[model samples]
Target: MPTTSTGSKSNPARHDMSVILVTGSYDHEIRFWEAWSGICSRTIARTGESGQVNRLAISNDKRFLGAAIHKKIHIYDIGSASSDPILVLDKHTNNVTSIAFNSEGQWLASGSEDSTIRIWDLRSPGNIVHRTYENGAPVNDVIVHPNQGELISCDQAGSIKQWELTDNLCSHELTPAGDVPIRSISLASDGSCLVAGNNKGQCYVWKVNDESTSLPRFQAVTRFLAHNKYLTRCLLSPDAKYLATCSADTTVKIWSISPGYDFKQEKILVGHQRWVWDCAFSADSAYLVTASSDHTARLWEMASGETVRQYNGHHKAAVCCALHDGAS
Candidate 1:
């Protein structure tokens, strides 16, 4: 069942059974908010060279949370009361841009400005790198396929690369937008569709074929102008019924997805004063939480297109958010 924010303090010690609504900001702090109440229930100080969080991901089991900082990652035990990170992963040579946990949460995949994608084995003694894939340009986003046998990544050079786990090779490459930075990518949970958002504020959709081979083929479905300014992130709802795109235009637009990958405008979430950087959908696809450079994060009710809650505690730009409501 989807967890509700009941105006109570977040019990980090009970994370596995509680709702998690976390946002990371340039203020050098990560804040956990009571989703519905908009209360900042917990805060953790982050200090480093960059002092800004680029991305955040919660393990599928809700046992751990990962924060991507400059050239490193901080992994936190969600059940712990300590404010310090349980493990610090320092492998990337440049800013780590993105991070994601596999379905089983046994490992984490990270993409970086270092031009590489690396998998960290959480089960290993020191959480060592399990595998690494080299890209020609700075990586922006990376995600694991639902089958856990492939990885897909997009880079600053606007190229999409698919790496096969068994062969340890890049099986396919596509450049939908030439030479422009592709900022984000989202794969449908069932692995049937892929969406990439670029600096030009355009989004490319593809139909994925993943059933027969280790390497999936992508067929161009459609391309559309998602925003007039840079598109920071594009995420497919967990239930695969909608797509959410946040941009430098200061708005988050929701698109309904239909058969054959047709998309129609659904809602325009407007409230942030600065760049809308990231967003995460609720497990049931009924709600969306967005982070913005305005130093706040807001929860939007999809059906009504209204801001249900506003989380305000950050002193600087809030760039990334992670939410796990235990319904997966």
Candidate 2:
């Protein structure tokens, strides 16, 4: 993990090269912030047919920021002075719901409401899509396994499908909770656990086992109701120590990951005025950043359960945020 700069928090001009935090909103703009200071350093207008930003992802190498808007994915240069996007991937027919980068940062993976998942090769000059997989249902989330050999995706039909990277085939299909729509999915960075959350505020857990198979198998662990309202997003800490779930109830709940996969509620982050849409864990897994419909994003300390910094520049609802604080 990288340590944040020891500079003054009120200094807006001092930018720390170690940390990068950005937020996208219905306000039709993306703001780059000084994470420790809560200062908006740069603002890029996201206008035209791209529509509102639905999700945001930072490449592992911290070279680019991928924004999923409407039916297109815009890639922006993070270290450059220009505000223009260097590349735009326009292949999805419907809204691009989720986006992520591979561990090497050589490729990008995205899932869409068009019922497909596409892998874009970042090293190619023509911006070629390496491959595409049809999910048969609107995909809500897709994540690359830590082993870099597979992809796991959850859809509106309440199905979790595991795709094998080597053979390009679906190896496992799991319907954890009947036919309810699955809103989000998260995998532990160490490949120890898999979690999926649904519209009914339920969360299901599974342990990743690699016994006698080339593809990792999911052993059922447990399921619990994490929220009373809609569960908007679920994310696992990079260290696999905590699970964070954002809800329409305007709170983010953190669950402690026990040794035996017994997850228990550790804290409930209160303060957001409206729906808590998205959140990201610091590389050290000690802090959290949350975006809300209240048009603000806040940084919270896990142990203290208090807001350490508040980012309040968005004109409309802040829907998504991306953070990269350490090298992969």
What are the per-model C-alpha RMSD values against the true structure?
2.9, 2.2
Write down the lDDT of every candidate, Cα atoms only.
0.89, 0.91
Where does candidate 1 stray beyond 4 Å?
Answer: 5-17, 47-50, 211-216
Candidate that would win on TM-score: 2
Stretches of candidate 2 above 4 Å error? Answer: 1-13, 47-50, 211-216
> Alpha-carbon error at 260 in model 1, in Å?
1.9
Quickly count the clashes in candidate 2.
0
For residues 229-323, write the lDDT of model 2, one tens digit per residue: 99999999989989999999999999998988888999999999999999999998988999999999999999899999999999999999998
Clashing residue pairs in all predictions, respectively, total 0, 0
Q: Which pairs of residues clash in candidate 1, taking residues 3 or more apart in a chain or in different chains? A: none
Full-model lDDT, candidate 2: 0.91
Task: Give the per-residue Cα lDDT of candidate 1 at 94.
Answer: 95
